[model samples]
Target: MKKKIKFMLLVYTLFLLSACSLRKDIHSYQKIETECDEIVQYLSEDDTEGLKSMFCNMTRSSSEFDKQIQVAMDYFEGKVIEHDPFTLKNDGSSVENGKITRLYSSPHLTGIVTDVGKTYEIKFYSYIINTDDEDKVGISKLTIKTDNGNECIIGEYIR
Candidate 1:
């Protein structure tokens, strides 16, 4: 009887652990989508301050900053970006490995002429919040398009 109780306790602990992990992962995934949408307002006005307001207080090192910026930079260059958020169609089993793997694809921007004598290619236009940081959520990396819809990875270095 003691052995059976121990086994049940172990199983209960494992179930709790997995449930917590899944909830965290799904919450993180939803955050990415929210960040994408919130960044849209900043992108429209080219407002870096607006972008900063959207972050939920996160921090990062310089190198990490560059990596996230690249994600945006690629989009600004007229590349379509698609994200694979753990949804698979061809698997025989329905359950995943309990670990969420992200797949990023495509570019989300197109080269377009916004007005006379001005064409724009998006540099990194989306603002992503660093969910793990407490003070860096408002931070955003960026680049911009030149008159001919060409991208310049200048970032908020200027604006």
Candidate 2:
């Protein structure tokens, strides 16, 4: 009987740890989704500064992130950006039973044209957030794809 109680206690302890951090995770997910929606809005209005802020929040303080945001700013200003009807998210920014402490953005899809009028699909390939509470951030590696199946990194930015 003592052995059974000890085993039950062990399981209970694990469950408590996982549940303690869960409510926070759920709130963070809501924020990410809300942010992505706001980004689409900024894209629609061609808001350059707003775009920069939105993208910057996802990246570390790197020059690479700065450059990509410029590209995004330029693209929105001149080239046409047609956002898809629905945003795409892999694994849905969620963890099982709540114990999730990670923050992530859903992969975003947008159609863009260069200044010279070349067209490409811009897809966010990276959205990394530090698991720790530190202020560090990471840029998501992004790829631009032409209809012909060729792809290249347009920019690595904190998105």
Candidate 3:
């Protein structure tokens, strides 16, 4: 029947659309994971410029950005011996008009735990906003602390 054929076509079209969306989500997840890895590498190498490049323009331009980065570098010293990969905890995305308007994530576990002479825990919050006349992206918040103390040696929150 024509009705049956039309219904099948409709289902097929919906399936294809969902598949595309799923692929895009996976791609975004992979990208976030890669970013996490890059952050760890940058910290381990004490590559200030490389780490700065990862942040959004808004964050990079902040007056305290350099100072905050220096604090983190000072607190985390020596060669990093070990680190854990990103464990996604909370994540969300907003899509409008067939485009992603915003995306964010906070990993379940601390971003990284490294043994560089001392144990250090790093945590981060990251987001991306894509809209007309406003584009904010990359790691928006970061914290670095030694596991032996309660003090947060390095904290940077950029809006």
Candidate 4:
């Protein structure tokens, strides 16, 4: 009877641990989606500052960050009229003792935006997140483009 009880306890503990891991993964996916939503919101409003605030400290401090934002703003015409669901290109995490020590993800967002009477194809080709530094726990790389295939704004601040 004691052996059976011990076996049951072990099983229960294993179940709990697995559940916790699953919860963490769900949370990570949700966070990524939320960030994608924020990107769309800021872009639709043409809020440069708002967009800037979404990036990591490293990116925000870079001299080219402003230029990247300006380029995107200049290229991406108007409010987002429609967008395809954000695709989770890559997602990974390093967990130590049931806590996430590092996390990374790349989400791709594509949509259409209408400026006066014309619509343009807008694509946030890459939204990268690498949470290795606690102080800079935000987007490390971002790329935005319009229908013009050759023109793109890229912001890369990796640490």
lDDT of 1 by residue, 1-159 (tens): 999999999999999998986786566556544554444445544454555454333323344544444444343432223322222121111124643333221123334333233445332322222223334333333344555555544223211
Best-first order by TM-score: 3, 4, 2, 1
* TM-score of model 1 (CA atoms): 0.40
Q: Report lDDT (CA) for all predictions.
A: 0.41, 0.53, 0.70, 0.69
lDDT of 2 by residue, 57-82 (tens): 43535567656655654544344444
Segments in model 2 whose C-alpha atoms lie over 4 Å from true places: 57-106, 109-122, 125-154, 157-159
| Better by TM-score, candidate 3 or 1 | 3
TM agreement with the true structure for every prediction = 0.40, 0.49, 0.78, 0.78
Query: lDDT per residue, candidate 4, 15-55, as tens digits?
Result: 99899888977887788888888887787788988888877
**Per-candidate clash tally:** 15, 2, 1, 0
**Which stretch of 10 consecutive residues in model 1 shows the poorest summed lDDT?**
85-94
> Candidate 1: which stretches are off by over 4 Å?
45-49, 55-134, 143-159
Clashing pairs in 3: 89-108
Summarize candidate 3's per-residue lDDT along 109-143 as a digit string, tens digits.
Answer: 25244554566666676675546324357776676
Global Cα lDDT for candidate 1: 0.41
How would the candidate models be sorted by lDDT, starting from the highest?
A: 3, 4, 2, 1
Model 2 / residue 131 / CA error / Å: 9.2
Looking at model 4, the pairs that clash are: none
